[model samples]
Target chain A: MPMTIDSSEVLKRIEDAPLLSSSASRLLQITADPEHSLGEVADIVKTDAALTARVLRVVNSAAFGLISTISSIDRAISYLGERLVVGIAIDICASQLFDKPLTGYEAQRGDLWRHDLRVAIASREIARLAPQDMAVDLAFTGGILHDIGKSILSEFLTGTAQSVLETIEKGEAQDYLEAERAMLGIDHAMVGYELARKWQLPEPLQQVIRFHHKPSEADEEHRSLVYAVHLGDIIAMMGGGGTGSDTLQYHMDSAYTDYLDISVEQLTMTLLHVEEEFSKMEASLLDGKDGGT
Target chain B: MSNLILGVGDFGASNSPGDIVKTFALGSCVAVILLDPGTRSVGMVHVALPDSSINRDKAKERPGYFADTGIPMLLKQMSSMGCNVRKLTVKLAGGAQIMDPNNTFNIGKRNILAVKKLLWQHGMGPVAEDIGANYSRTVSVSTNTGEVVLSSPGRPPWKI
Candidate 1:
């Protein structure tokens, strides 16, 4: 066993990590309460020039195919719905964080970003087919941020990435998380959970980051949400977004399917649409910045 | 050399010696790479599923995404690029399965079997490969050297 760093050190390192845009952060805060009016939130989004520019660019982007211009943040919100607009803002912010390569995990430029986006897309799809009560935007956010820990821990693991992957490849470790723990005394899931907490995201979303790889371990109330993100992770891998050294080391937990009364066939069909959904999302919103100018 | 990438459900052929062709992370999917030294041409496809029979609608549009239609379609593309079936050397990679007992799909094995059957019909086989392990691979073929390199992080680079 290699000498491992303690959790405290990892916490201290991430203490100053980059977080969501202040406008996006306040937007999440105001929207978290059930009673807030969307116009109030849109008014806040309208104030941040950078945030407003992103929203207007996405709203008018070819993805929406709007016949008439949206004209304002409130009009854009009315057209796309409050959840997705916030999602767009959060997505733009998250995309910046995910753009870099995590070499220890062997992610090339744009690999992690693509994978996380696909996962977020898959989670939105899975949410529809799973339990009806699953929070829509939360599911998407959880999916995108599920692997944030890998990005955080990657810089620390560069020297040992080889040995860690070798152990997993050679069967000394069961999977990437196990390999990470044995070598570093911490794993991506826990680190990701901590990062989510530090970002002041809702608790349920934090649970998703922590137990996505092992949904059974999540608390009862959050089990369904965890299931959606978990299946989303697997489907993203199936869709060819599966990159990095760790690859598909994650195992599918059938118990979640059993618990949720969803069949593998049902799950598989939903999964088949993952690539299509990703393409649609990419073509519509993310890459459509080119369409405006 | 510049790189030409074939994303999922994609296929491409090139006779240009200045371009390298590549596809990333072939899990259950298979990447069939063909190189013809005589013409200095290379053709590649990233096959995402085993058989398109289940989804005939998709097969009509994306025949290169399935084994039955994809491998043949890839061969036809290579043929258009002056690659002779008898002279073309093939390289195969990807088909890693989930390292879990509950992995029921076994799409990786199905992909490999399907590719082998198609190649058998053509009287050819993979000249070199590094396949069927539980790791995602990024594979590239340089038109300059006709060398295919498969890498998975810490795993030593496998060259064909």
Candidate 2:
């Protein structure tokens, strides 16, 4: 008999996928702390030569435009901040997954990375403007890993794009997430949550990965952070940084207004900041670098 | 022959007959295309926002990012290239309402309105447009034939 595929099958595949490097994993854990120090971040980079070089290059890149070259890992981590340091570490560790072609979504290679970068920038920007205090770096980190589920889900979704779209169009499904659940017996969020568990990502980051599309579903303690990433995801898509067929298919939970109180003018400003920061980071990190595995 | 690709907050113009000007993946952003039949001159601006009052510095740095600034700059560039305003054919593409259902995030609608208002202020309007959708778009204009084409994901490129 042909095997019946389900979320278990997707979970099994996640176990087979390459694990995050020990250094990258350590960076994620260290940076998740609101009081994480420059030394803690520097210690992780000091051990990895490739990551150290990339961090130095990015700090000196045209994006920062420092007059003097800083060769020390401590200065580099301090200058770039733990958020971006973590981003670079993740980019190096998962370049293959980040830069892969989302064949099911009909998206090009590097599309996912670009989208994630935009989301990271936008998330950080929104978090800075929120009325309540929150960890902006955590939001940025969440944005980077929010759509990781897509990398694995794409293979299972091959040749299903038209049906998914038609299902959305006909209102048989609420959005792409629902469509994925209806067809595949599992959505990207659940698949991503399972991966987060496997990777041992922080609870807040895991919540962001699962509830980004619907922030209300996240735990109350992390709701605001999740909301920031939710709006950040929307802003990234609005700014034309979406990944393929399901680009704008997800519903924007207006409940975010309850968590993040900001006017339309402020929202527009966030878009500008996202574009500016996205261009700089893309040029520094991924522009000339070989993004392939 | 050259294809001038305009990124967000950017615009370009070409008078060469073999040139094509285009912008990619316009989600909420709008692209204004100007073509002059007399000179075969074409210009394209990828407008990202409605007004420049929000950030004058960004507007100064990249006038092609806002309808209030970008439209005027494109018109000025086309005229400077010796293309006649009266002879210009205005066509607009993009300005899609991607995820906003409650109109809370209505940048696409606002952008469409702003671009139309700006063009009206210039005493012209889009002769043809493909605007206000839930999908993203990539728009291209041919300086050779004054042809405006739009392509979306999973869809064929079509002329407007």
lDDT of 1: 0.76
Model 1: what TM-score? 0.86
Local accuracy of candidate 2 as per-residue lDDT tens digits, A4-68:
25767777788876789999999898888877787888888999988988888888776667788
How would you encode candidate 1's per-residue C-alpha lDDT over A1-293 as one tens digit per residue?
44577767777767767778777777777765556887888888888876677677777777667788767888877776665666666666666557668877767767776787788878877777765566656677777778888877776677666777667767898788898887677898999888888878777788899999999999988888888888788777766675477778767776765435455455445655777767766665664445361
Model 1: colliding residue pairs: none
Interface RMSD of 2: 1.9
Weakest 10 consecutive residues of candidate 1 chain A by summed lDDT = A284-293
Q: Give the DockQ of candidate 2.
A: 0.59
lDDT tens per residue, model 2, B61-130: 9999999999889888988999898778998888877555456689998999999999998789988999
Task: Give the least accurate 10-residue stretch of model 2 chain A, judged by summed lDDT.
Answer: A284-293
C-alpha lDDT of all candidate models, in order:
0.76, 0.86
| Per-candidate RMSD, Å | 3.3, 2.7
